[model samples]
Target: MATTTEADIHITKGHEVLKLYQFNTHTARHYFCSVCGIYTHHQRRSNPQEYGFNVACLEDVDPFELGEVPLGDGVNHPADRN
Candidate 1:
């Protein structure tokens, strides 16, 4: 996954097939491909100013190339505590 501001990102193609998913508090907007059911990106609940995008789902991106990536432990979401 990668992080970027909403204004910095734009789906050039296949955006028509993307569907929004909202669970729990519904503050975070998760988007996925309606046809393939692959996660695309999400407006982060932790930081609404940024979006977390699935690198593998994007074009010309090979997640394998980003070896030894560090990720957050999302097992305890801040919203869940509330």
Candidate 2:
């Protein structure tokens, strides 16, 4: 996942490339590339200030090289408890 501030993400190429999908609580939004059908990023419900992005969409970056990716407990997410 790419850790970046909301302002850092610039859509230089595909301005209309993403399609949004909302599920469950509907607080978070999942964005997919409309052309290739690839998951690009999502607005985090837990932390609305941040965005969770797919590292594969980044230029010249390999996810395997990042090392030790931590998984979030989505099944027990605090938002779902209510």
Candidate 3:
């Protein structure tokens, strides 16, 4: 995952570079690079106010250097419950 602050994220250069996809509930959107097919980021379903991005897309940053990333239980997302 990419380390991002909500206000810091923006698609500065490649406005048309990525393709978008969403499935089932259509609550989240996944973006991928059209040329390289790299998963770039997603409009998170759990928190539409934020985005989840791929660390690989970040320039000059190594995800391993961040240490101990936490995982979330998307399968049991609270929003899905009544």
Provide C-alpha RMSD values for all models, in order. Answer: 2.4, 2.6, 3.0
What ranges in model 1 sit over 4 Å off?
72-74, 78-82
- Model 2's C-alpha root-mean-square deviation from the true structure amounts to 2.6
lDDT of 2 by residue, 9-70 (tens): 66666758789999988988889998999988888887766887889788899988988888
What ranking of all candidate models by lDDT puts the best one first? Answer: 1, 2, 3
lDDT of 3 by residue, 1-82 (tens): 6545568789865659899999987988899989989888888877676887988677888888888988777587656678
Give the winner by TM-score: 2 or 3. 2
lDDT of each: 0.89, 0.81, 0.79
The better-scoring model by lDDT among 2 and 3 is: 2
> Relative to the unseen true structure, what is the Cα RMSD of model 3?
3.0
Candidate numbers sorted by TM-score from highest down: 1, 2, 3
TM-score, predicted candidate 2 vs. hidden true structure: 0.74
Q: For model 2, name the residue pairs that clash.
A: none
TM match of model 1 to true structure: 0.83
Show pairs that collide, candidate 3: none
